[model samples]
Target: TIAAEGGGGWKEYAGGYSDWANYQASVHQAASDKAKVDVRPAARPVAAAAKAKGDKLSWKEQRELEALPERIAALETEQGQLTTLLEDPAIYQRDAKAAQQAAERLAAIDDELMELLERWETLESRAANQG
Candidate 1:
């Protein structure tokens, strides 16, 4: 059973945790879907900025810049997973060495992400300035 208070006052749901979790996920998905429809999606900032500035990049630089976002996203996802693993006390209890490795990876990901973002900014600036 889930009890939540809102503008409509108190409401209760008759379901177990899994059902409530599913309902919550569906509600979030509905909101996200609605937002996607209601909003006018804009081009990615870097791409739009590059286009506006006339895209002075070599084909190689342009491709590298384009691929950076996906690479950054993958690193970020791995970082989040590692962070969650580290946060669980059971992991340390289960395998101290694994926890240490996760911590090291999380730190490495942070550094890598920072470098990628810096590279992105530098590329964006280079594109704008050369245009």
Candidate 2:
């Protein structure tokens, strides 16, 4: 039962390259997903160790931090007195002369406080570096 042109002699077949295409697609996907690894210079041990110890802090650091509170209090004490002096009507009116003198004294104390506070800040910075 063959056709006159021998059409039935050969089985009809599909010419497909789907398997190769699928394999190439998988290979390309794998290439895109490949992990990347890199190496870089390590940090300096001296500087890094210093920074790590600085982060942890220590007994000396605690004392230095405590001094900050004392410095802040001492520096601002004059502000409290100025507030009181400003409020007292007796000193502002009848005691204008005395108030002037007291004001001068308070200014001197303010200057001294500023100097001490600056010194304290410097010391604090040095202590921080020691870590």
Tens-digit lDDT string for candidate 1 (34-107): 55665434436856776676648878888988999999999999998987886565675688678666766666
Q: Give stretches of model 1 more than 4 Å off.
A: 1-55
Candidate 2 regions with alpha-carbon error over 4 angstroms: 1-68
Using Cα atoms with residue i matched to residue i, what is each candidate's TM-score against the true structure? 0.56, 0.42
> What is the Cα-based lDDT of residue 53 in candidate 2?
60
Highest TM-score against the true fold, candidate: 1
lDDT of each residue in 1-131, candidate 2, tens digit only: 11122654532111224533443354345434332221213425633664666544567656766776677686477667764774464664576567655555555566557655764665567567667
TM-score of 1: 0.56
CA lDDT of each prediction against the hidden true structure: 0.70, 0.53
